[model samples]
Target chain A: MTGSPVPPELYAEVLHFYARQMQALDGGDFESYAATFTADGTFKHSPKLPAAQTRQGITEALHEFHKKFDGDPVQRRHYFNHVVLEQQEDGSLSSTAYALVLTTRPGGRPDVGPSCVVNDVIVRDRGALRLKSRAVDHDQEFAAVAV
Target chain B: MTGSPVPPELYAEVLHFYARQMQALDGGDFESYAATFTADGTFKHSPKLPAAQTRQGITEALHEFHKKFDGDPVQRRHYFNHVVLEQQEDGSLSSTAYALVLTTRPGGRPDVGPSCVVNDVIVRDRGALRLKSRAVDHDQEFAAVAV
Candidate 1:
């Protein structure tokens, strides 16, 4: 992507948005996490899994995601890196990132959970940046487990 | 974190450097990977592990790192995101990012290896961007496994 420098304010806003989104997910606050997206936002966890569209759908999907680790007191942490944001021709922002998910059981060693690539479209709504669509591509082998 | 916008050229350069570095590591080309750093560059995998200083030291450490997964035909992939770069007071560039290391063994499902935070100091010498220091902070439990 080639263009003029990204404004500091825009970069700062995107950074802040991701921080809040991560905190919400880590704290199990699905409500807050869902709020980061637009009303018609869409989340694709993997190619095989049906996409979660709309705020309610996203929230339910996240709830089910959290339930996967039920019966085991495991802590989940997500790390993101190599985020590249660019302004699309339509004026919305498009982003690509990589994610690492780690899980640790009580008194047990940490285990790698999954690694995936994230592609997102961000739009401004009501004066705040929100996710329009997020398509996550999991590694081929990992996608089998994730789905 | 508050200042004028980062020059587009500088931002592009850092992005380009990381792309090359990741390619080298994924391709198991230690020679190319080691060349990404300065002569006195340092790599700190974790607090408990001894730091690797200088070009030779960094290359040797990577060699040993790759050896750990020996005897198993595995593919290693590194994904980075949330990269934030700022100009430091000393005129060098300081960057903070998150990384996901994934490994896939032959006929086995892909697994998450480690999720860590990467802090880097980048400098220009001979007209190319090179890493001067890279300090990685893994999650508490992950750090134990990494070291």
Candidate 2:
């Protein structure tokens, strides 16, 4: 809310973008999920995890990930909340939000995998908003290791 | 996005209002949390749960609810996302968002209690946004249950 007044449409657009990306991923439509990012976009769950270095990389990774749930009735959903957007001089946007990974299975209780923070660099490609990069850091990762 | 372009500011305001309310509740500032609702506000987690019929009622309920967490290292975080804002004819805003209740304990894995949908009726009170009503529907509760 500080600095010059920002157009309200930008806020809604930012949220709508996430709605599109997450739903596509949860629905197992990796192609639509990958469409939310630029060709050379990058995504990493954490510094300790392998990252997808491009749109195709993520799509392929998602396909592999989808295989893990085979024969089991399970669902994973990513929810982003408390988003804060900052405009960059490079005509990109820095979007920071709290993310929760939720898993649901038939007859079993839903589970929260982790509470994490997600940082995304969003850019306009062909007049559509797309992510340039995304990174996640989980709360448990902050705990000390016994090693 | 339909029925004549509404000011984008309204969209941002709706999201921000949720941000404030959720943080206040999670931070255990019941007074600040209660202030988010109107004097005649109503809140119910679900149709089967008890309802708070007024701001005063919710504040008292929160105080009683806080006692249940006594002596345990636990944290509850409410996350709201995938929000859609609609302008109503009565000058109020109808805000619908997904709600996730996440619980974390020291040295224990964080768990997701439920994936829920929250519908809030937000109205302006002395130029400030306030919730007139809030109702939640959880995914699990929708499943078939035997008597």
Candidate 3:
């Protein structure tokens, strides 16, 4: 068998990070979600909107963006697949994924939204993987991630 | 650092299997979806329902299942995460995942449905990985995977 270029532990760590981080976002624990990013991390949703440049900014932006959902009150979820990871010479990782957004009201049907792709710069922060940058590019307009 | 018990390539192959297989299911390609299973594969969705006993049966069941969606005509998606894989001594894989089913209509809101867990026995068939058995257990009643 050919040797794997990347370490298996790295894959485990990254997947673990996603499992916890996305749960925080979907579960409305914005603080815990934002904490997965580096202190100076940036989250850029689109070219039109300014990037959330810090952890505090990310939390605040989530709080504001969620205001609209309060009226409709459906649970929002993010599912990512086809995660391709490449390691930089400097030891950081560049990860890309196809992302899907799903929402549902209590006792209602689920609707899967527009297709999107996310590219991220992940780095080791105090021995754990943290996002240094996250750029979400939507193929079309979806109310959930509209910025 | 300790060595990884699981090979990195194993993780890669299992993920690749999921990526292609789920796309086939959500994309309305029942033949392609069923082809991923072993010829004698069994799919048991619940204790109440009899398992789809073979690949042909799996395809037929999918055709019948999608009839319900024809009137609604929304995309049905399966998203899986938190994958845990264990390898048997005989080189087969026992994989488990937390799954989410999403649905959406044309120009409509997306809904995320009930939580489910899927356990599968994956084995090599003609040098390619194929599902030997898939057992999906739902946490609650969800119309999408009612069978």
Pick the DockQ winner: 2
Residue range B65-91, candidate 2, lDDT tens digits: 779889977888987777766678998
lDDT of 3 by residue, A47-134 (tens): 5689998999999988988898877888888877756567799888987766787788989986666656678999999988899999
Candidate 2, pairs of clashing residues = A8-B8, A112-B112
Task: Give the better candidate number (1 or 3) by DockQ.
Answer: 1
Q: What's the ranking of the predictions by DockQ, best on top?
A: 2, 1, 3
Poorest stretch of ten by lDDT in candidate 3 chain A: A138-147
Off by over 4 Å in 1: A1-5, A142-147, B1-76, B79-101, B105-147
Of 1 and 3, the candidate ranking higher by lDDT: 3
The 0-to-1 C-alpha lDDT of every candidate, in the order given, reads 0.75, 0.77, 0.77
Query: Alpha-carbon error at A42 in model 3, in Å?
Result: 20
Q: Is candidate 1 or candidate 2 better by DockQ?
A: 2
- Check candidate 3 and list the clashing pairs: A103-B111, A103-B112, A110-B111, A111-B103, A111-B110, A111-B111, A112-B103
Stretches of candidate 2 above 4 Å error?
A1-11, A20-76, A81-101, A111-147, B1-6, B107-109, B143-147
Q: What lDDT tens digits, residue by residue, belong to model 2 across residues A1-147? A: 765333458767777777657766765788877888888999886769798978789988777866777776566668887789888888888989988787776555677668889989999887778989999888788755523
Can you give the lDDT of residue B78 in candidate 1?
A: 75
Per-model DockQ against the true two-chain complex: 0.13, 0.17, 0.10
Order the candidates by lDDT, highest first: 2, 3, 1
